[model samples]
Target: MDLPVQQFRSEVEQGMLDSFAALQEALPGAQNEKVAKLRAKAIERYGSLGLPHRRIEAWKYTDLRNRLGEAFPMVRPSGGPIEQSEIEKALGPRIANMDAYRVVIAEGEFRSELSDVQALKKAGAELRSLAETLEHLPDDLEPLLAETGEQRSGFEAARPTGRSGAGPDPIIALNMALMSGGAVLRLGDGISLDKPVHVIHLDGSGEPVGSVTRLIVITGKGASLNLIESYAGLGGRGLQRNALTQLVAGADSHIEHTKIQREEDEAFHLSNWLLTLHENVRYDGFQYTNGGDLARNDVRVFFEGEGAVMNFSAASMLKDRQHSDTTMVVEHLVPHCTSRELYKAVLDDESRGVFQAKVIVARDAQKTDGKQMGQALLLSEGAEFDTKPELEIFADDVVCGHGATSGQIDDDLLFYLEARGIPEPQARALLVQAFVGEALEQIDHEPLRDALTGVTADWLGVKLD
Candidate 1:
C-alpha cells in the first residue's frame, strides 16, 4: 500500500492565501463584478501553483519559496500626510533634482500631493491611479491585465519547455489577487511630451509589510514619450515589494523607458515588466539594479506587429550575500521585427547573480533579427555568476543568436591603469566601470545615463573623474 503524499506549504505561501481571503473585500475594485471574478480566479491559481522554487527550471537558481521563509502581513496605506522633502531625500541627489514630471507612490498608495498631477494634466496626458481606474473598469484594462485569450495563448506558447511548463506565474497571480494601488498613464495620438515622467516609489512603513503596486502605460499612434521609474526605501525594515508594469506601444510610437531599483538592503523586491509593441514602433529600455537582499526582475516582450524595433539593456551590482536574478523572454510573433539585448553584472563579496534570457521567433516571423549577450565580472573568489542565453527559432530565414560570458576583471587592464599612477583601488574601480559602461551607454537620455553612471561608480566605492 502506498502512503498518501503530504503537501507542504511554507509560511509565506500560507500567509498569502490567508491574506487574500481576509483582504478580498477591501481590495481595490472589490465591488466590480469583473474585477471580483478576476481576483477570485487569480487567488485560485495562486493556491494551486504555490510559490516558485528550485524544482521549477526558471526559478532553479533563486529558491524564493525557501528564501522568504516567513511572509509579512499586508498593510493598507493610512492616508497620512507626507513631506516632499522626505521624498527628495529618499530619491537622493542623483535623481531628486531631475527635470521631469514626478509622481510619487508611498507604501503602495499614490500620493497626489507629492506628484505633479496638475502639471501632467496640463500637458495633455491622461493619468489616474489604479484604484481610480478600477472604480470604473475600462475595456483596455482587460488586455493589460493579460486576460485576453490571445495574450494568454501567446505567452503560453513562447514559454520554454521545462518543469515549470506554462504554469501561471505565482508572483503575478498574487499581485493580481492583492493589488491595491498603482498608476496608469495614457497619451493620445500624436501627443508628445516635453519632459520625461518619473514615477518615484518609496517604501516608508516603519514595520515589516508586504506591498503590491502596478503601473500601466499606453501610448497612441505617433506619440513620443520618455518614462522613468525609480524605487527607493525610507528606512524601511523587512519590506516585501511586488511591483509590475505593463506598457503598450502603438503604431509609429517612440518610447524610451528606464528603471532604477535601489530598495533597502533588507528588503525583498520582485518586479515584472510586460511590453507589447505594434507596427513601426521604436522602444528603448534600460534597467539598473543594485539593492535589496533578494531581488528578481522578470521581463517579457512581445512583438505584435511588423517593422517594430526594440533595444534592451541592464546592469546589476551585488555585494554581501545578496542574490539578484534577471530573467527575460522576447517573442517575435510577426515578421520584419528587430531586437537587441545586452546585460552586465558585477558581483562582489559572496553575492550571486543570475541572468536568463530567451528569444523566440515564430514560423511566420521570417525577417526577425535578434541578438542577445550577457557578461559578468566577478570581484572576489566567493562571488558567483550564472547566465543562460537561449534562442528558439521556428523560422529558417530568421537571424537569431545568443551568448553569455562570466569571469573576473582583466589583470592586464587593471595593471595598465595602476602603472599610469592610478591608485590600486581606483584602478580596479575604473576597470569595473568600463565593463558595465557598455550597457549603461545604451541609455539615450543624457541626464538619466549620467545619474546611473554615478550610481555605478558609487557602488564601486570610487568617483569617476
Candidate 2:
C-alpha cells in the first residue's frame, strides 16, 4: 500500500507564483527585453528551488520556510502624489534634519518630488530610477545588472557565497523578477559627494503589499560617498519590505554605509546587500534594528583586490516577541585585505535574536586578516538568542578568528548599578545600552550614531545623555 506524502508548498510559495505572473503581465517593464529576460530567469529559478528552511546550514538559526507565511503581490502605486508635507511627516524630524540629499521611495515607487534627483545630477552624480534605467540597459550599468560570485542554492544556505561557494538565492531571484522601483547611483571619477545621500524607504499605506526595491551603487576610482538607508514600516498588516542593494567600490574609493530599521511591530523587513571592494578600497558599514515583528538583514562582501579594508558592525534590541536575524558573509579573494565584524543583540520578553557570520580567505589571499565576534544579552527567561561565527582559511599566511557568546544580564552589574542609586529597570536598561552602544560606536558618523542610540534608548525605556 502507498502512503500519503505531505506537501511543502506554503501560502508564500503559491503567492509568489501568482505574483510573478502578475508582474510579468501588468508591470511597466513588461515590454523591456532585458527586464523580461531577468524576470523570466528569476521566476524559473525560484520555481526550481522554492523557499529555504533550517535544513540549510547558514539559515539554520532562522528558518524562513517554517516561519515565513503570507506573501503579498507586487505593490502598485496607490494614493495621490505625495506632497512635501507628507514627506516631512513620514520622515520625521530626525531623518529630515540630517545634512543629506534625500531620496524617497514611497509605496514601492520612486517619488521624484520628494527626492533631490535633479540636484544630484547637476552635481555630476548619475542618478536614475532603476526601473527607468533598466528600460534602456545603459552600458555603464551593465556590471550591476549581471550576476556575480559562485553558484548558490539560495542565499548563503546549502553552502557559502564566494568563489566555489553555496547555492543560488531564490530571494535574490525573486527580487529581480518583480522589483518595482529604486535608484541607480554613481559618483563621477575622482570626485567626492559633498553631501551624504539619504535613501529613505517609507511605507504609510495600510495594504498587504510587498516592496521589492533594488539599488545599484557604483563609485569611480578615488571617489567617496556616504549612504544612509532606512526602512520606516509605518502601516498595514503583513507589510513586507524586501530590498536588494548591489554596490561596487572602485579602486581607491571609499564608501560608508549605514542602515536603521524602525518598523512597526506587525511589519516584516528583509534586506540583502551584495558589495564588492576593489584595490585599496575602504568600506565602513553599520546597522541597528529596534522594531519589526520579523526582521532579517543579510550581507555578503567580497574583497576582489588588494589593500581593501572593511569594518562592519550591527546591533539588535528586540522585545515583546519580536524576531531579528543578522547574517553576514565576507570573502577575502585577494591579498592584503582586512575585515572586522562585530554584532550585539539584546533580547527581552519573548523576543529572539540570531547572528550568523562567516569569513573565507582564498589560498592565494596572503596577509589577509579577518575577525568577528557576536555577543547577546538575554533580558528575560523566555527570550532566546542564537549565534554562529565561522572562519574558513585556505591561505597559510592568513589570520582569521571568530567568537560567539550568549548569556543573561549580569546580576553583579545590575546590583552595582542599583547600588549606585539607579532602579532595577533603569540599571538593566543602562547595561543593555552599554552592551549595544559598543557596537554602534564603530559607525563613523556621529549624528547617525546618536540617532540610532536614541532608538536604542527608546527600546530600553531609558533616556540617553
Candidate 3:
C-alpha cells in the first residue's frame, strides 16, 4: 500500500524526523543496544504518524507544535557547573524542615550534594541515577517509553493522535531518544517508611534548556511509602521540562504522591504519571500548579484487582499570561474497584486552563463505582476554561458519573461576605478559596495541605478570614 506524501510537511513533523535521525547516527553499533533499538522503533513510528496537533482528541486542548516553537538536542554527557547553595536557597518553606531523603537534579543535571543516599539506604530502599541503573532497567519499560509517541494501551488505555494529517507525537519520541537522567525506588515487602523521599527537578539560566526526568516507584506487598516531587525553578527565561513517572503498588500496599510545580513564568512544563494497583491497594495523590507559562499533568490509573481504590486530586492557580492544564484518565478493569477524582482551577487575568477527564469500565468489571468532578473560577474577562468530562462503561452493573462547571464567583455569596464588613476584593478571594478548600480537605498530610492553601492565598493576594 502506498501512503500519501504531503503528510510530512509541517515543521513539527520535519523537526521530529531530523531529531530522531540524528540520535540514531550519534549512537553507533550495539553499545546500549536495547536503548538504540527502542529509539529506532520510536523514530519509525513517529515518522509514519507526525506530531500531535489540535485535531487530535487527546491533544485537542494543548497543542505542542504551537507551544514548542523549536526542537532542542539532548545535551551530551558533560558534568557542568551547578550550585548547591542556589538550590538550598530556592527550597520552599514547606520543605525547609524536611530532613528526609533527597535527590536533586539541577538544570537537567544530577547533583550529589543535594542527594541523600545514606538516608535512602537506611530506609531499606535503593536510589541510583538512571545512568548508573541503565544495566538494571527492565525491558518491559522500553515499550512504554518508545510508544509514548504512539497511543497507549493495557488495563488502562488512551489513544494518542498525530497532527492534522501528520502521524504520532514527536516530542514523546524525542524523550525516548534522549532521556539520560532519572531514578528508581523499590521498597521491600511489609516495610513502612515514615520519612518521605523528595525528588527535585530544577532549571537555570542558559540557552533555553529542555529535560525529561523519569522515575519508577515500586512498593512491595503490604508496604507503605510517601513521595514528594518538587518541580522548582527561579522564574527565568524560556525553559522546557517533560517528565514521566510510573508507580506500581502490590496487594494491600499504600502509596501517596504529592507534587509541587512552581516553575518560572516563561518555563514550559509537561508531566505524565501512570499507576497500577493490585487487590485491596490504595493510592492517593495531590498536585499544585501555580507557575509556568504552559503546564499539563496527564495521569492514568489501572485497577487490576478487586477492592482496589484510587484518589487523584489537584489545585491550580494561574495569573498573568500563564497557562495550565490537568488531564486524568482512570480504568476499572476488575470488579468491585473504585476511583474518585477532583480537580480545581482558579484563573486570573489573561491566563488559560484546561481540564479533561474520563473514566473507563471494562465489560467484566461489575459493581465498579467511579466519580469525577472539575470546577473552575474565572477571575477575568480574558481568562478561559475548556473542560471535557466523560464516562464510558462497558458493563451494565457499574455506577459511573462525571460533571464539570466553569463559571465566575457566586454573586450572592460574595455579596453576603461583603455585607459582613469585608472589602469586596477580599470577599471575592475568600469565596474562591472556600470553593477550592473541599479538594484540599482530602489531603492526609497537614503540612502539605496547609502549604498548598498558602500558595492559593498568595496567588489571590488575600488573607484567609
Candidate 4:
C-alpha cells in the first residue's frame, strides 16, 4: 500500500493566499486586463513555489517560511492623519532635517499632503503614485510589472545548484500580486535635478498589518538624479513589509540611489532592488540596514549595454536576536562593463548576519571587470555570520573575483585605543564606526553620507565628535 503524499503549508502562506483572494477585486489596477493577468500569474506562481525556505539555494541562509509565523492583514489606503513631526521622529535625528524633495508613504499609501509634488514638477520630474498609474494604465507599464523570463532563466543557469522548477522569485511574485501604493518617478532626456528626491516609507498602524509597495524609476539619456529611500516604523509592532523598486538608467545617465531601513524591532522586512543599466551609464547604490526582527535585502543588477559602471555597497547592524540577510546578483551581458560590490555587517549579542553574492559575465562580455567583497564584525561570542561570494566568468578577457571575511574586533587595536584617553566603550564604538565607514564612504553625497554616519553612530550608542 502506498501512503498518500501531503504538502505542508505554513499559516503565513495560507493567510497570504486567503488575503489575495479576498482583496483581488479591490486591489489596485483591478480594472485593467493586463494588470489583472499579471497579478493572476504572480499568485499562481507563488502558490506553486510557496514561501522561500532553506531548501532553496538562494534562500538557504535566511528561511522565511519558518521565520514568519503568521501573516498580518493587508494594509489598506486609509489616508490617515500624520504629523510632519511624527515623520521626523520616525526618521531619527540627523536625517530628519535633510534638504531634499520629500515624498511620504504612510501605512502603505502615498500621502500627497506630505510630499513636495510642486517642487518635483518644477524641477522637470514626473511623479505619480503607483495606484494612480495603474488606474490610468499607461502603455509601457507591462514591462515594469512583469519580470522577463530570460532574466529568471539566466539567474537559474548561473546558480551552482540550480533550482529545478523555480519559475519566478516568490518574494517578488507576492509583492506584485498584492502591490497597492507607491511612487513612480520619471525624468526626461537631458534633465538634471539640483536636489535629491527622498522617498520615505512609514508604518504607523497600531495593530499588525502587511504592506506591499512598488517603486518605478526611469531616467532618460544624459539625465542625472539622486534618489534616497528611508523606511521606519512609528511605534508599531508585528508589521510585515514587502517593497520592490525598479530602476532603469538610460545611456550616459548618472544615478545615485541610497536606502536606509530602520523598522521597528518586531517587524519583518523584505526589500528588492531591480536595476538595469544602459550604455555609458554610471550607477551608484548604497544601503544601510539596522532594524527589524528579520530583514532581507535582494538586489539584482543587469548591464544591458557596454561601457556601464556600477558600484553597490551595504552596511547592516544587528543585535539581540535580530537576523539580517543581504543577497546580490550582478550580470554583465555586454562588453566593456564594470561592477563592484562591498558589504559590511556588525553583529552583537546573539544576532546573526548573512551575505551572499554572485557575479556573472556572459560569453561575449569581453573586457568585463567585476569584484565583490563582504566583511563582518562580531562583537559578542554568541554573534554569528555567514558569507558566500561567487564569480562565474564565461568571457576570456574578463577580470572577476570575490572574497568574504568574518572576525571579532581586533584585541590589539582595542587595547591601543584604551591605552589612550579614550574609554573602552568609546573605543569599541569608534572601531565599529570605522569598520562600517568603508562601505558608507562609497556614497558621493556629503549630506547623505554624513547623515548615514550619524545613523551608524546612533546604532553604536555613541556621539560622533
**C-alpha lDDT values of all predictions:** 0.86, 0.80, 0.74, 0.88
Candidate 4 per-residue lDDT over residues 1-465, each given as its tens digit = 122222777888989989999999999899988899999988876776688888778788888989999999998657768887888889986787789999998888988888998889999999988988888877876887987222532545444322422235778889889998898999999999998999999887578899999999999999999999999988967889999999999999999999999999999999989899999999999999999999999898989989999999999999999999998878899999999999999999999999988887888899999999999999999999999898877789998888889998899999999999889989999999999999989999999999999888888998768
The global Cα lDDT (0 to 1) of model 4 is 0.88
**TM-score of each predicted structure versus truth:** 0.95, 0.92, 0.89, 0.96
Quickly count the clashes in candidate 3. 4
Candidate 1 lDDT over 1-465, as tens digits, reads 122222777788999889988999998898998899889887776777788888888889999888997888886687787776776677778787889998888889988887888998899898899998887889979756743212222445554433433445778888888888889999999999999999998887578999999999999999998999999987858888999998999999999999998888888999989899999999999999899999999888989989999999999999999899998878898999999999999999999999999887887889899999999999999999998888778788988889989998788988888889999999999888889999999988899989888888888888779
Q: How many backbone clashes does candidate 2 have?
A: 9
The lDDT, on a scale of 0 to 1, for candidate 2 is 0.80
Arrange candidates, best lDDT first.
4, 1, 2, 3
Candidate 4: regions farther than 4 A off: 1-7, 148-167
Residue-level lDDT of model 3, residues 124-208, one tens digit each, is 8877676555555476555555545222224323332343212344555555665657777888889788777888887665566
lDDT of 2 at 47: 68
Off by over 4 Å in 3: 1-6, 20-30, 75-85, 88-91, 96-99, 136-171
Give per-residue CA lDDT, model 2, range 242-324, as digits (tens): 78899999999989998878777777888889988999999999988887888889898989989999999998888899999
Error of 2 at 292 (Å): 1.3
